[model samples]
Target: MEILKRPMGDYQTNCYIVKIDDKEIIIDPGMGATEWVMANVKNPIAILNTHGHFDHVWSNSELQSQLNIPLYSPKGDIVLMQSSTWMPELPPSTPDIAVDGDKTLDISGIEVKFHHFPGHCPGCSMIEIGDAIFSGDFLFEGSIGRWDFPYSNAESMRESLQKFAKWTIDKPLYPGHGNPTSVRAEQRNVDYWLRIV
Candidate 1:
């Protein structure tokens, strides 16, 4: 498996392209991501979003049209995707598949899992592919996603942290912002986030 990451937009949101064998999966095609993704992918199979935040999914419709691939988004953020919650200029993108909480599917023979961890947004989740987990805005390097934004809930974040505490399987975590970390690495900090958040 090959993973390529490039930060996009003013927010510097991380957009990832995960390649396994001949097929590639695009994760979180944020603002100004279309050009980079177009250059990087060959056999693009599907577009996956961990959550539906303006900065995280700004280039969704553009890429979907260009690549002509299926889009899989968490069910909870459908509203956020279809409507401009944060940025009014946000281009509305619709998902071909709406992933309910913590569901896994076979995307062209590859196991793709969506681990629902709502806190930053209603449909906030982490996309798990192979040994890597694309944590959209859930778990960062040392800090967790803020629950201060609209549609964000502090209680949900706390619950998600509690749920994460029990996650025994550790994998490399690629967050929406900043550098990468591991599930185990962030797990150790979950307690701190739980206390403060």
Candidate 2:
């Protein structure tokens, strides 16, 4: 498996392209670099989002059109994805697949587990594929997501953090922003920042 990270737009959102065999899965294709994505993916199967925040989902429409792939996200975040004010710079696009908690999706031969973890947004989720967890805004390196937005909840965030802490500690987490970190490292020390929120 090959994972490529592209830092996109002003938000510096980490857009990931996960390639296994001849198929690819594009995660969070933010603004700019559509051509770069096209060059890498051959018969892209699905476009996955961790959440529907504007910065994270800005480029979905264009990329989806270009690649001719289905878009997938947690069911609850469709509102955020459609709201013009929330995602002002983004074009109109609805997810073809609205995933539920703990559901497994088979993309070609890769099995991706969707973990519903609502806190950052009502439909926030973490995508677990093999030893990697695409954790969106849920948990970052040495930090956690903020619960100040209208859809965000501090209690939910805390619970999500605690739940994540108890998860198996072997995978490397790829958050929406910042550098990647191990689950064990975040579990041991991320609570310090979560406590202040």
lDDT of every predicted structure (CA atoms): 0.93, 0.84
Residue 181 CA displacement from its true place in model 1, Å = 0.4
What are the TM-scores, per candidate, against the unseen true structure?
Answer: 0.98, 0.94
Give the candidate number with the greatest TM-score.
1
> Candidate 2 — which residues are off by over 4 angstroms?
none
- Which 10 residues in a row give candidate 2 its minimum summed lDDT? 83-92
List pairs with backbone clashes in candidate 1.
Answer: none
Candidate 2, overall lDDT?
A: 0.84
Candidate 1 per-residue lDDT over residues 38-111, each given as its tens digit? 99988999999989988888999999999899999999998898778468999999999999999989999999
lDDT of 2 by residue, 103-147 (tens): 899877889999888888888988988778998998888777888
Q: Candidate 2: deviation at residue 146, Å?
A: 1.0
After TM-score superposition, the amount by which residue 43's alpha carbon in candidate 1 deviates from its true location, in angstroms, is 0.4
TM-score, structure 2 vs. true: 0.94
